[model samples]
Target: METRKLGDSDLEVSAIGFGGWGIGGAPFWSTEGDNASVKAIRKAVDLGINFFDTAPVYGFGHSEELLGKTLKPVRDRVILASKCGLRWSREALGAISKNASRTSIEEEIEASLRRLATDRIDLYMVHWPDVHTPQQETLETLVDIQRKGKIRHIGVSNYSIDQMKEASRYGKFISLQPEYNLLSRSIEAEVVPWCLANGVGIVAYSPLASGVLTGKYDKATRFKDWRSKGVIGTFQGEAYERNIDKVERLKALADSAGRTAGQLAINWVLRQPGVATALVGVKNERQIEENVSAAGWAPAPEIDARLNEVFARE
Candidate 1:
């Protein structure tokens, strides 16, 4: 496994990070038992995955707990990242919303510290921007906390270019985690270039297009998980048919390249100029092993040219 620097920050993380959302379980995503999740995480560390990203909202903190249990033994050997600003109830499952206020950020940081069982967080990011709170105030608080040593570095997720610019005024943002993939590339037109100019590392989530680019779904395929059902709404009707058609073609292309569709997708993302890492969700050790195979390998220029042509026409 190779590593890359995160923007201008001193931290260097693995090219491929283990996403904690899937292991979170429950209404969020389809998951196996806690034991399986723990094994997968430990195996990830053994396989040289140094970056692990999670959020408190994932399984209402269960994901962090599991990660903490597995990684605590090798704490100094890994870079831990988690997000805040999305709060929910403990008694019942409800709509989780953003709260980037100073008070809210302070409270969430303490809770995350407790769940993660660590004194300092490597990269602490605002899971999403808060409309009610000003960006200046939120970032100022993050800077103060970083100075106090509760958080090592500050970053933002799901933030627009303007919002990131505003945040830079108050504090340093070394990375931006955005939903970017073959099917969802609107960010490349603006967000990606903006980050590249400002020295912000791109941490691409859902780089598999929520599994659609993995060649596992078809017109008759259906999802039962709430996260999949809600976030994958675009994968229906005409769009669904068109995407499936494109995937079939891409699969043929991948086979010609001696790769799987998922591996090809990951390779495409890593080849992008500003991308520092791609987060791939894993339910078991098999998924981690499969996703990591894309690392340390670069496809020829012609393959990428053909891929760009295939995706641009969509």
Candidate 2:
């Protein structure tokens, strides 16, 4: 496992971070059990994964709680990154919505701190941009909290270049968390360059394309999860079929490279410019082990070129 500096910050985070979405369980993703999930988190720490990313809305607080409880003993050895903005009243998928207003943020931070059981969060991010609230208001509130020593560093997730610039007008954010994988790379054209030019680190989520790049699912295989029809990326219809077709091609290249398709996909993400880390979701120890294998390695030149071509942005 290798470590990289997050943006221009002093924090050095693991290149492969543990994504806490799946461990939350129910309403979105299903986990084996609390015992299994806890073991997986501890296993991740054993394997040198120092960065853990979670959101308050994930399982309506379960993800943060589990992560808090599991990592409390080694809190000083790891970086805890969690998000705000998305809130929920009920533990249901439809109940969640973005609310990054000043008051909402003020409340969200306290709740996150309590749930995470952390005195100060290493990285506090806005899960999504709340169009209803002014960017100035949200960023200013985060700046105030950072000043208060509640949050160490500020960041944003799923934001466009313009939104990031507008938010930066009010406060500084060191990183941008985006849905980036071999299948989804719209950020390469402008966003990556923007981050590189401005010194903002990229934390790419869904590096497995919600499991599509794992080479396990095919055209006939259907998903029963939230990925059945995402508002974000392809997980349905002819577009999904097309993605599957490309993945089928990727599997061959991965075989030629002596790596599983999932590992190859994650390795590709890690090698991309401006990516400080690939936030991989793990439900158990086995899954995290494969994700960890993608790091500290590189594909042969020809295979790397073939991967880029197969998943080339349209």
lDDT of 1 by residue, 166-275 (tens): 89999998999998788778788788889989989998898888788899999877666663355533566777788888898889878888899999998888878799
lDDT of each: 0.87, 0.92
Model 1, residue pairs in steric clash: none
In Å, residue 248's CA in model 2 sits off its true spot by 1.3
Between which residue pairs do clashes occur in model 2? none
Best by lDDT: 2
Misplaced by over 4 Å in model 2 are none
Candidate 2: C-alpha lDDT: 0.92
Per-residue lDDT, model 1, residue 85, is 94
Q: Against the true structure, what is each candidate's TM-score?
A: 0.96, 0.98
Total backbone clashes of model 1?
Answer: 0
- Give the Cα error of residue 230 in candidate 1, in Å: 3.7
TM-score, candidate number 1: 0.96
